[model samples]
Target: MSGSDRRRGVIALREESCTVCMLCVRECPDWCITIDSHVERVPAEGPGGRPRTAHVLDRFDIDYALCLYCGICVEVCPFDALFWSPETDYAEPALGDLVHGKERLGEWLGSAPGAAQPDGQSASG
Candidate 1:
């Protein structure tokens, strides 16, 4: 896709870089991030099969209406799971429209725009 086809302002997750330390989970102040496990299928090239990987993210919700966008959670994430993106065209007419959960968080993970923080350097993961 071309650059114009992309989103302009938002926040997102970098899953591959996620260390699952749960710092964002704990520091959210909003109970946004929830840890969970799931079955993952490795690539067929390897001795692959469905294996249960601790997703660590049962949910990573953000209540935009209530979100001060303080970037507090972003700053506290040790694995760089929380980040700001230039894709903020979110629209919701009702208050309930602001309760974003796992699916939305995962969507951000799927199409964010940069590299995550390096592993091992600790902030709060």
Candidate 2:
């Protein structure tokens, strides 16, 4: 298969789309993903309504040194916040440098591949 047809690669995360649900952390076979969040109160929609609590992401980090590149984290994310980035040049001189933070992970979004079109379907179809 050609390069475009292959899907295995590093993960790209969208912090805005992530709800800090911890699904990715729980599902990771290598336990490479780490997330920290805190509950925040948001204004209610109507008067006298109770404020809604949401999880505000504080930290999201992935240790590439321990990752197996299995793509399980991407599959378990319900919010579509995780994706496969075609970029493969993330080698680091030290093991500590392999652990990427939220900002670094989000940067990979720019190189992430677009959603695949359905098989046997053309854009004009």
What TM-score fits each model? 0.56, 0.85
lDDT of each structure? 0.60, 0.83
lDDT string for model 2 (30-83, tens) is 999999999999998888888899999999999999999998999989887888
Candidate 2 TM-score, true structure as reference = 0.85
Q: Write the per-residue lDDT of candidate 1 for residues 3-80, one digit (tens) a residue.
A: 866534556766555666767657777664555545455444546545444454444567777665656777887666
Least well predicted 10-residue stretch by lDDT in candidate 1: 116-125
RMSD of every prediction: 9.2, 5.7
Model 1, which residues run further than 4 Å from truth? 1-8, 29-55, 109-113, 116-125
Mark the regions of model 2 whose C-alpha exceeds 4 Å error after superposition: 115-125
